[model samples]
Target: MQDITVISMIFTTILALACLFLILSPLFKWDTYIQVSSKGKDINATKEALLTTLNEIEFEFKMDKISHADYKHLKKQYETEVASIMKEEEELMITNIDRELKDEVEKEIEAQMKTYKNKKGEGK
Candidate 1:
């Protein structure tokens, strides 16, 4: 009876430690959560700012306070600015995706290398 209680206590402690390690591992090891959250916030802010600028430009054009040439020039400027922002956002997204893919590929290569080493060791 005492042996059974000791074994159960040891098993429970080991299981608890394993669970704690699993929970804390990601917190110490990676920035995936932070990076993704920051990117999402930045993209949302940029989109909102661009939309506000576009609405203001349209309102001014509708009010007819500016001449046709001025309106055209301003519209072109806004379009260019918005397009530049979009391009930058797209590039950032692509960069993030590429980085993740590269990491995955590297991990796969490392796993393959480990497998090869194990096989070679077994053959020896």
Candidate 2:
């Protein structure tokens, strides 16, 4: 029947479009949460996960689900991990700033040399 044919055509068109979209989505970077391997991002994610786990561990201890000895061990371990992560994050930021400053200074020096050369050539 004509109705059946029309329905099939419509469905085929939709399927084709869906396939095309899936194929192009990655090329266009339509994914909302692209995982980047930057040190800062990893540090923040690790810190957040550790903090969440610490909160859960504390709650469990309060609810009498964990022994005092075990709770203390876990809390101390996680606190130490968080502290290290924070220190690393700070160091990464300082390193990044220093690198950017170096780059900027190099660029300025290059620009000044170019300008000086141009002026010297024009005076000849």
Candidate 3:
């Protein structure tokens, strides 16, 4: 029927656009797609997203949906991205831990100073 043909064409166009968006999304880094999710916008989240995308690409390749060249290119790009994301996360975690330790040490020193002052007063 004419109606069925029209609907099928519309569906095909939508599917093609979705594929294009998926292909271009990594290059452009769609902010909303990656940021506004439940996982959050941290380095870990970004790495997870990249991993998921990489897995999807692998699955698609296995299913014969994508060409070998495209699969190879996308896989390499995603792996590089994931490595950088994890490296940044590791550095950030180290900095946070260092800052927390310094704060705790300062607090302990202040408490010790107060105790020393109290002891002096008692001796006098």
Tell me the alpha-carbon RMSD of every candidate. 13.6, 6.0, 14.0
Give one digit per residue, the lDDT tens place, for model 2 in 1-124.
Answer: 9999999999999999999999888787533355554656777988999999999999999999999999999999999999999999889889999999999999999999999999999999
Query: lDDT value for candidate 2?
Result: 0.92
Clashes of each: 0, 0, 0
lDDT of 3 by residue, 1-124 (tens): 9999999999999999999999887888576665656432566667888999999999999999999999999999999999888877778779999999999999999999999999999999
Candidate 1: RMSD over Cα atoms? 13.6
Please give the lDDT score at residue 42 for candidate 3. 67
TM-score of 2: 0.59
Candidate 1 lDDT tens digits, 17-54: 99999988977845676667687676668777877877
Question: Whole-model lDDT for model 1 versus the true structure?
Answer: 0.85
Q: Go through the candidates in order and give each one's C-alpha lDDT.
A: 0.85, 0.92, 0.88
Off by over 4 Å in 2: 1-40
Query: What TM-scores do the predictions have?
Result: 0.59, 0.59, 0.60
Alpha-carbon runs more than 4 Å astray in model 1: 1-47
